[model samples]
Target: MENIAGTKSSLSWAVHISVAALVLIWLFPTVGLFVSSFRTADQIATSGWWKAAFPSEQNLTLRTDPPSTQVQKGGQWVIEGNLFGDKRGATISVYGTSSREISTYKAGETGKFRNGATITVQPNGDYVASSDTKWKGGRGPRVFVTAVTPPEFTLRNYQMVLFDPANREGMARAFFNTLTVTIPATVIPILVAAFAAYALAWMDFPGRALLVAAVVGLLVVPLQLALIPLLSLHNDIGIGKGYLGVWLAHTGFGLPLAIYLLRNYMVGLPRDIIENARVDGATEFQIFTKIILPLSFPALASFAIFQFLWTWNDLLVALVFLIDSTGETTVMTKQIVELLGTRGGNWEILATSAFVSIAVPLMVFFAMQKYLVRGLLAGSVK
Candidate 1:
């Protein structure tokens, strides 16, 4: 009775909970990356992305107006300015004149300098410094302040990561390079595998079973085992290490799964349709182009998503086959690795670059995801 058709299962609630938990587990870091990408370094350092919408306390080292801006006021030289400059709305809680005493004076109190100069800071970040003797030096003294700042977000991270002309490690070039590698790597295998899958699924040929077994066996072959030998072969053939080599490598590695997935899917398509098309004077080429390709879109799209993501995020293959001393052919994965080495402490930049790296794949996945489950499940039922 509990398993009656059209009745809900007793564990449906558990399934729902499990799925929701999985979604949240995957979603949390992605959402964190999206939020952190728009934040400043100081903000990122002080708090997590979950706290981004709330005011945060931060100890900041700032400089007053240069000594050149000092003026003779009454009998003393004076420098007056807002510590935040054009920025506003931060409330200083405590201030200090040196790094060792970062919270020595509460806001709105006057603290005396070594030379009898007095400086006063207000909670609103306004400050006035005065000294009896004329202030010497081209730069003003440093002021460290502990302030509660309102939530702040900026597009400067994205600008620096994607568009800054002077940024040598920017992701723009790597992004386009990844697209260059990914698109061709995805499309070429799909085109080749679609024909092979159609032939395997429908057209009778000698040694077909052995070829299918070989493809199945190839699926279990470790990609790393063949890299050096395949690379040597590429060099021997004059293809060398470049886009062509990497594209072929990705296509070769991707073809087995593509053929397996598409063959299973094409085999499940109505056989009567193909037989009728042949009986109605359609050639095998015509039957395939007109009948098989259109019906196999879901499987094609499913494999596209897989291959695109694999090729896009692939660092080892690109490192072995594509990257050179010029660095012009570098992809996002390699560029991100370089960033980890060079800018490990710059969390905002890392977050922005990581989010940018996943942006295209996310778009592609969401666009074609409906077909993914359908394609995977095509021959499983019948």
Candidate 2:
């Protein structure tokens, strides 16, 4: 008995450890993308996301107030101001008047220049330079400062991707266009599949078995094979490359699986409830609307999540059927692909755009995961 109990405990620990490993593997890239989106372009390029919390030393060429802004105080020429302009706040480790001697003076120490001027810079970027002789020049003296800047983050990437109208490559229109494609594609299929599934599961009809077999057969067919033919058909039918065409394509491609899943799920629902509704003088439409629809929430939600994700993430279907040279109807996934071509070197922009594209699908999955699990479990019951 003790041996069996020990084995069971070991298996439980193994299962937990395996789950932890899988979760980490899945979350690692997403967490990296989320962290990268907040970082400046330089920060993302220089180090990994895990190192973002640590202070980083950077050599920066900064300028003091121009000689034109110098004031005469205490019978001496002076140039006084903060070196790190509105950096929020950063720590200066060392600084120097010449690039060759960038780290010559420690923070809070004074250094004498070749021109008989003394400059003092504090850790917080406040600096003072003074000379008995008047300073001359249109430009400020360049100071090389080695500073340990605090971990920096910015929302400018997301702002540009989402809201900056001036940015021609922004995803605002693409995002809405994706929504336009996804909502109707997701909803239309479920409604059509649910009604078909009800007829297959409950209503008496001929060739029902053959029809279900046909749906099962269609599931094995590759959607890729149909894309070209479907495009030709759409072009001929006056539905060339638009939301309506994409919606119809997604609905047709999705229906086989939808009908298969909903039929199997609805077939498992207790027939007694359906029979009771019939005895209560409920019409078939009323029974489906009031009884079966309420009972089929899990299946509906499951299929909705599936179809939503598929349509949202699909690039091939959208490319083949929807997007045009005008580029007005481009979706988020296409927008990301375009970013890869245009802003390939801009990691901050790429990461931010990718995350924005996936954010909605992730939210929908998390929100309906319970129903998804329920539907899968219920569908599994013979």
lDDT of each: 0.91, 0.89
Task: Flag regions of model 2 displaced more than 4 Å.
Answer: 1-4, 8-19, 72-78, 94-122, 128-142, 275-283, 375-382
**For each candidate, C-alpha RMSD in Å?**
2.6, 3.7
Off by over 4 Å in 1: 1-22, 378-382
Q: What tens-digit string does per-residue lDDT give for candidate 2 at 32-140?
A: 9999999988788767788888977777889888899899998999999999877747789899988789999999999878777989999999999999998888877
TM-score of every prediction relative to native: 0.93, 0.84
Give the C-alpha lDDT of model 2.
Answer: 0.89
What's the CA error at residue 190 for candidate 2, in Å?
1.2
lDDT of 1 at 243: 99
Q: Write the per-residue lDDT of candidate 1 for residues 176-282, one digit (tens) a residue.
A: 99989998999999999999999999988899999988988897789999789998999999998899999999999999889988998899999899999999999
The backbone clash count of each candidate, in order, is 0, 0
